[model samples]
Target: MTATKRCIRAEDLYQIRYTSDPQLSPNGKSVAFVETMIDEQRQYRNHLVLQSLDSKDLTSLTVGAVRDTFPRWSPDGATISFVSNRSGTPQIWLIDAKGGEARQLTRCKTGVSNPIWSPDGKHIVFSSMLSPEDSFSDVEGESKKEVQKVIVVNRMKYKSDDHGYIYDKSKQIAIVNVESGEMRAISEGPYNHTVGAWSPDGEWLAITANRAENPDKQHSIDVYLVPFSGGEWKKVTKSKGTFFFPTWSPDGKKLALIGSESDTHLHAAQKRVWVYNLENDEQTCITAEWDVQVGDSTIGDVRSPGHPNPGAVWREDGKGMYFIASERGNSGIYHTTLDGQITQIVGGSRNVYGFSLHEKAQKLIMVVSDTASPGDLVEVDLDTKEEQRLTDVNHDLFAELELPAVEEIEFEAEDGWKLHGWLMKPVGYQQGQKYPMVLQIHGGPHSMYGNTYFHEFQVLAAKGYAVLYTNPRGSFGYGERFVQACCGDYGGNDYLDLMSAVKYACNHFDFVDETRLGVTGGSYGGLMTNWIVGQSNQFKAAVTDRSICNWLSFYGVSDIGYYFTAEEIMANPFNNPEKMWHHSPLRLAANIETPLLIMHGEQDHRCPIEQAEQLYIALRYHDKAPVSFIRFPGASHELSRSGDPQQRVLRLEYTADWFESYLLTAEKASV
Candidate 1:
């Protein structure tokens, strides 16, 4: 009998690609999306591509090293506008829909993003930072240098490593004449404002603003109405919570906004859609019991809505609104009436991102994705609920590879609470032989591991390891109560839930070898792996990536240390250092017996490389286990997703080698 492939390497992983940000033209004759490709040099870049409705005559609009995204069709569908950083900094660029050389629209020293064309297509409104010198005043009596000194940071989480430094120059909404290039700030203040939509009548522009004295401290975001001609802003709604992403109704009588209750933790917050009446200014929550959040943000603000694409659309008659909500285990598009009744319009195996509705043709052009495919463009008939795939970006990739099958699993925690997880067995398996198991952990104890296409998980299964991942108590997708379970108790119940998943997988799958188990994860998952080996020696080997080892030091060092340690974990560096140390994995390093490999980015401000250094030093000092540390230069916390391509490939290869040496071969394991 021939033996199955003992282990898979990084080179064996399939090359899968997908498209996103699908935008349909007003006439419904053509569709556009951001097509991402790995060049011959292995560098990732995206460009705008157009495809006709009737034929597959695809055309690439933007080219070269520049990455273009967020393509928005003009009101008349004559032009397309997008944001690109090809010119050193991200700026707005316009190109004719038919085809021509793209023209630069904005030339500010800082940068501009999210350009929205007015109703008449005569002007374009976008968010950007003006120069600090522009805000200085010329004193009457003294020279301009005599003013008192003040440091200004406009928005909450001003010092973001990923987005760079945000100054006192708030991202005010600026409008520019499409023809003459004349520009004016319609909504101006020390506060930050983002444009939502322009009323059909062109009298008012709907916008979202967070203008509190301490914008960072205030969790609530409010929507406002600003005159198109430029004047005082009118407040539409006020609350202790955050409210944003204001979309105007077609008739201009009502406004739709995404609201979140708080920011204690990712799961502790409740997100919903609310409609505000223009006359009474009364806000009604449309998603009261849906247990779904509507927006996405890099920072921890629950109130800030995700960037609006064609996903949220106003009905042509203005009697109803349509938005995408992730509930019932998947995200789907739903239409809600004025009476607060919601009807599911599109239901399927894939998640609906956003849709462009053509009322005249009764057709809905949307971006959807399943577990196997990354994402693709599709069209659905709103009336008939019939769907058809439009793009085949990943068809060849899927056909050539044998992907792992993911199944949802539920297991009871030690405390009788049920937990959710996803399990992926080897692609080609036998009945009698056992396979090595790898417990994969996700970052953001609050981030959920859903039915999505995860390249890492697929690659691991292809390498002959049965992979298991779970969304512990603090993960999203479940309601508020399920998420708050991990607030102050980080390594407590969440750790137990993961332990229970491992046990369940071992008991149910006879092909899993309990003795040859290996574990790996990044970010929060990295923290868990560190905590796991320190507490138990059940696993033969472990790898932790960008993990947190010492909480006391993290509180003072990390960018979000001050807020996250105090608000979320409810711990302080001065008073509760012991509790923080007790939860830290470094404290229990002496008990760790498994051979461990630690990987981190050199410039990760979120969880600095010192965290990995502390763990490595502790393990080596005690002489209890073999420990190795690898650092990627100039890399950040997002190395797994957006790191340098060559470095990312090496990182994955290093992780697989560590596991293969320890778990696959007994001779290497003993050494």
Candidate 2:
């Protein structure tokens, strides 16, 4: 007889670990990736691991207190360079690939991150903040110290109350000589520059900079080229749209960058990739006919999956570049030529992250995911298109568990827009026996819901709840036009599309009980949950995390609020405050009848905690609904993914408990 599976709590069963950011060595003989492991103490820690191409022998390169990431190999392949905070603050560390004590390279009071090795391997380029200094007086020849202070007077529209504001330090690129240990500033200015890439000859460095005349504008980000030896910076493109993820061609004659030229919140207006010629300074749109924008384009409280943050690299021959595209489903890697002819290199239910080419072997190494697994390193044969799994980090844990099965579904929105969705039936589910259903909405209204494994979804299914998540309009993986359809029409057609997904599941799935329905999400998804509770009584319980409730207040509070509001949500916060209010879920709190469990981090700089407090207070004041508020101490906006370990488990338990009290209990009462 098959052994009875032990019941896995939402917290205990969700400790599955995986690998990410796989970096192939320069010689193509070995691969290094960030291996995330959950220890016996249940603490999540990251360490660098190496695997040989020939023997497939895996070895751990780092072990200790701090986390190590962004492993890049030197040109000689004898040493590996990475970032770590072992010395109190994040700094560059170098260690032999065979494993030994890592030597600290940079010792700055501030932190250093995003380390990229120059082509020659003699220098490492990274970005960090500059130290603050006193202002100098020319006439008096006396130094005047400017005291920087931060004050939080009230907690209203801003989400995070405990967030302490400090003096702003612009992130500048710096180069450290590997041999001399000499650190020199390569690019210095008032504007922050990040996401650096090196040219083949190491003569130039390409980076995505917000050095525009109006750096405050969220849409003003563009790519720029700077001399590797440190001098003047040159703008590559002048479009007012957001451009990032700059990848230089092998020949260094052209740059393959992802960008969008429109300000519309919809995917269509925000999705496009451009190739710029360095010689002529001419630009060409490669994805113009894809009818979809690339990257998530929503300003505030909304996200899209299509925004390719880690841009793909060009083939060694520079004939084509590999990139991930998402329109209506999960993201997949595709090869696109300069002429815009695209070919799907890896197509599956899962999302394919950026790939590293093994030029000599004609193989591609990538990170991929599906509903059953979080993410794993896989190698695909470029010519044969065959995929082979390289890592089994989570295999042992998952093999003993009974995970949910994700099935794709489609439904028509209120406006007849076709939407895609995925449904996860309860574990040990039986036909005829009704179960509670949870509707999971993805943020980035531009982000697509695909075959990727979601911990929360699996935990809900294990607890006898059927989970349903959909790719509404504005979701990626479908192509440009479909994604942009929801732009400027937040909580309108997208709301209908999500509701239709719920309706379709209830009607088609035999075990789904319509009366026992719950909804939960984080970030943009969190905003939708707030909007859903306010607009409908169909859901019995709802949980919203790191959400934006009011756009007017968010405009000044969020780091990206000013630009996101102006470009994605509103034309101008000053003139469009009413429109922002109209789209805000907080404005309709009076109509909410569903019990809400509001969750937010104390240190969330993205969507502050005040947004949660506002909804919690409003719900408590209402006699019609029950409410609960939970704050994660010392947690940031990314509490769900990168927060404290214990808190992450608690958050999941809280969500399950909220639904258990409302949805499951209500179903039992009716029975």
> Which predicted model would earn the best TM-score?
2
Model 2 per-residue lDDT tens digits across residues 1-671: 12756444666533667677788887787899887666667666678999887788999999866778778889889999988877767778999999999998887656677888888889998877652341111112233445548544332222322224433446677788998778777666556778568998999888887775555444467788888766787888784676778888889999988877665542345556789998898989987887644542222111112222457568888888877676456667777888889887777667665457776787778877777777788988877888888887777777678876678898788778777887898888776888889998877666666767677787788888999988787776676667666667788888888899999999989888898899998888999999999999999899898898887887787755765666557545677677888899989999999988899998887787888888888877876788889999888876776666678889889999899999787667867
Shift in Å, residue 508, candidate 2: 1.2
Q: Model 1, residue 438: what's the lDDT?
A: 95
In order, the Cα lDDT scores of the candidates are 0.75, 0.75
Candidate 1 vs. true structure, TM-score:
0.89
Residue 339 shift from truth in candidate 2, angstroms: 1.5
Tell me which residue pairs clash in candidate 1. 220-241, 221-242, 295-306, 296-306, 311-354
Q: What is the lDDT of residue 359 in candidate 1?
A: 75
TM-score of each: 0.89, 0.91
lDDT score at residue 609, model 2, on the 0-100 scale: 83
lDDT tens digits, residues 1-671, model 1? 12522333354332445677777788888887787666667666778998887786789998888778779899899999998877767777899998889987776556677788888888888877643454212111233455548766544465444654455556677887888767776755676777788888888888888877777566457778888987787888774567666788877888887766564542356567778898886888877856664532111100112334442577888777787766424667788777777788876645665567777678777766666766678888877888888888877656667767677788899999877777888778777988899998888776566555666766778777889888778776677677677778878988898899999999988999999899888888898999999888989999999999998998866767766776556788787888888888998899999999999998888888899999999998999888899999988888777666667778888887888888888844556
Whole-model lDDT for model 2 versus the true structure?
0.75
Model 2 ranges with Cα > 4 A deviation: 40-42, 131-166, 263-269, 292-310, 571-573, 667-671
Provide backbone clash counts, one per model: 5, 35
